[model samples]
Target chain A: MDITNLESMPGKKIVKHLGLVQGSSVRAKHAGRDLLSSIKNLFGGELTSYTELLQESREEAMDRMLQQAKSVEANAILNVRFSTSSITQGAAEIYVYGTAVQLEATE
Target chain B: MSGGSFQLIYVIGLLIVAYLIGSYREKRHYQSIIKREHALNSLPAVNLKTAPKGHFQHELVMGNVTISVDYFKRFLALLHAFFGGPITSYETLLDRSRREALLRMKEMAKEKHAALVLNVKYETVSIFKGSGKSIGSVEVLAYGTALIPSSQAVASNVATTTQ
Candidate 1:
């Protein structure tokens, strides 16, 4: 399925508005990575492990969102947005939402 | 009394070292960020949801950065919390991470030969949330759709023909 954060596909026409679809995933940091991150904090720099962990979580959320779009028979998803919130000290939830729609070729 | 003095000295030593290293590292990062931003000035990323009128291909592009708060800044933040003032120490951290994320996104667009990026948005997350004891870090993610103008293809064609 085609996915974009824009309101509408640039070259395509939206034929059907399928409403809002969302996906979310929550993940907790591993103890080992936390230890490493603390050490990295002392010097100050990018937290590679946390970056990777969050990236993975985001991908999973996107995947679930795409699945929802597919189930609804939508050809594209638009106006996509992502939000992150910490549910607890170590766990974070990544939520992605977008409007699912069917698009017709304008060309 | 001597043991208490020893603890105080140790804390002071850590603060001094953290301050020196953190400032040096932040300076270097800002230098690199400014240089790369100058280099990538040609590509403009905007918040417009619709692309400019053109026959172009679109692709999703994103860049994310996670930066950890150094001990020195965290200490400053603790003081700021106590005094209830604007925590200026963390401002640079957020600014650097946001710029870095946007630059990375633009770099990806440049790779795709996209003339413009649209509907750019940012999401910031405090990955390790809660209190001061935890090592705090912020993650910034910048995302947009890249529009590769069809004119570039014709331009490339003309170049090949001229050769």
Candidate 2:
């Protein structure tokens, strides 16, 4: 599982040489926070609702990513990336992706 | 005597304006903090590094992040209206970006089957700058090495399953 081998497996179309593993989670409830935030705006105060939403979404995304790694029989995953997109007014999509590789023993 | 009273009144008005301006800046600072906290917490913990088992090989892992200044600026402005001072929006942005980059590096290592990442470094590049009232964007890059544990090299580390 050397990081260098992440993209360099021998005889391994990346599509075939590498396994396609994925994890995804949809999060809602940010809209409620956003609403509260607008109200707080008039009075000029802290927005606690958004704070909670962000925390919850982050955890859910991470959990999904881990499950993906386990499915690939990969003890380790490298070069992970995260992207966020709005699914709807109150919901968001979080995606985590990386290369999965098999480990070899050292001499 | 009336003129003297008028002058005093003018001075008091100027002081009030200054105080209001200062308070506005302070409010903006807190508002940015709240926004950044939201961004950071919204991001999930991701590890992509794959652990290498025996021999060590040098590897490269890269992570990139782009942040919108407009979103951040508005958050700060909101705070400024409530409080007053120069808001430190840039710092919060930097912190969140770094965290994201680091997490990416770790995920790369986990994917490669590396035990850990080493010799990590970071660089920041300005991708865009605000013109007038428009917002800007900043990019952050993180790179690191992924290594595997030596213990796995031994036969004992191999997993055997009964059929």
Candidate 3:
């Protein structure tokens, strides 16, 4: 499905509003990884382990969101947004949400 | 060696190393950011849902960055709590990461042949919380929708480059 963070697609018409579709995931690093991060933090740069963890979680959440939109027969998802929050010291939660709708080419 | 004196010595050593290295890295990152931002500034990323009047198709674009405070900043931040005023050190940390995230979004829009990105948004997540305190690694994600012009002249580049 086509996804855009605009309220309306620039060159397409929304034929039907399928409704809101959303997905979320909560994740945390293993103890070994968490310890490694603390050591890495001493130097201060990108935390590859955490970056990879969050990236994977975000993709999973987006996949679930898309699946929800597809279940509603939406061909497009609009006004998409993502949010990440810490559940605990070592854990994070990611959420993906959007408005689902059917579209028609506006040529 | 007395415990108290040893602790002070270790903390001081950490502060010196972290301050020097962090300052160096931040300066280099800023230079790179300025150069890339100058190029992507023309892409016009905004939060308006309405696309400017044009014959264009819309595409979603995203950029994300993760940044952490150095040992020095965190050490200073812990002390800032006692005074309870504006934590200036953390301010720079957040500022750099936020702008970095936005610049990345603009770069994404430019690469996709989008003239402008609309409805830009951002989300911040704390990746690591040190001892349940005020120091942590945070991730910032900036996203938007790009308006890709439909004119054949401009469209030719995207067509030839991607497929």
Candidate 4:
């Protein structure tokens, strides 16, 4: 399925609007990575472990959103946006949302 | 030298070392960011929904990064608070994170062989949400649409030139 953050797909016709679809995921830092992160923190640099955690969580959320769009029989998602919030010291939450729509090739 | 002068020399040495390491790290990070940005300059990133007049086959692209402040930056920020002035020390932290995020997104677009990325957007969140006075980890997420020019658009010309 094609996804774009624009309100409409260029060179395509929006045949139907499928309303809003969203997915969210919350993940906590693994103990092993947390330990490594703490060590990295002492030296002062990028915490690869935490970066991995954030990446994983965000991807998971995006995947779930796509699944939702698929269930609605939408061919594409538009105007997508991502937001994140920290739930606690070790946990992070990511939310992704967009409008699902069906597009037809322009003649 | 007197004991007092010797102690002064030790303190000064510590400060000098801190300054050297701190500036060195900041410079290194900036240099890397600049290099990555230069590599991605050819791939246009914009907030427009429409493809650049003559483009086809658009896809979604995303990149994210979580960067943390080093000890020196945090220490300087704290010291700046005593005088109630702006905390320029922390400015680089956000700068690095945002640039890293964009570079990552651009890298993904390159892998997809995309010519440009449109409708780019950015979101930033502090990992230390509830904690006050401590911005431990900062994350920036960048997303956009990658467009590739249509081969079909040039197919007619190719056919004529060959004939």
Candidates, DockQ:
0.62, 0.09, 0.66, 0.53
Clashing pairs in 3: none
Model 1 lDDT, full chain set: 0.86
Candidate 1: residue B107 Cα off by (Å) = 1.8
DockQ of 2: 0.09
Can you write out model 4's per-residue Cα lDDT over B1-163, one digit (the tens) per residue? 6999999897666556655766677689899999888878988888777666775777788888877665556667767877787788678878888888889999988876778888899998887422358576688889998776677426534665899
DockQ (model 4, Cα): 0.53
Question: How many clashes in each structure?
Answer: 0, 57, 0, 0
i-RMSD values for every candidate model: 1.5, 9.8, 1.6, 2.3
Q: List the pairs of residues colliding in candidate 4.
A: none
Decreasing lDDT order of the candidates:
1, 3, 4, 2
The regions of model 4 sitting more than 4 angstroms off are: B1-22, B129-132, B152-163
CAPRI verdict (incorrect, acceptable, medium, high) for model 1: medium
Q: How far does residue B151 in candidate 2 sit from its true spot (Å)?
A: 14
Please identify model 2 stretches exceeding 4 Å from their true place. Answer: A1-18, A30-32, A40-48, B1-163
Taking the tens digit of each residue's C-alpha lDDT, what string does model 3 give over A1-107?
A: 88887777756788999889999999889999889888767756667788778878888999999999989999999888898888887788999999999999888
Q: For model 1, what is the alpha-carbon lDDT of residue A101?
A: 98
Best by DockQ: 3
What does candidate 4 score on TM?
0.84
lDDT of 1 at B46: 96
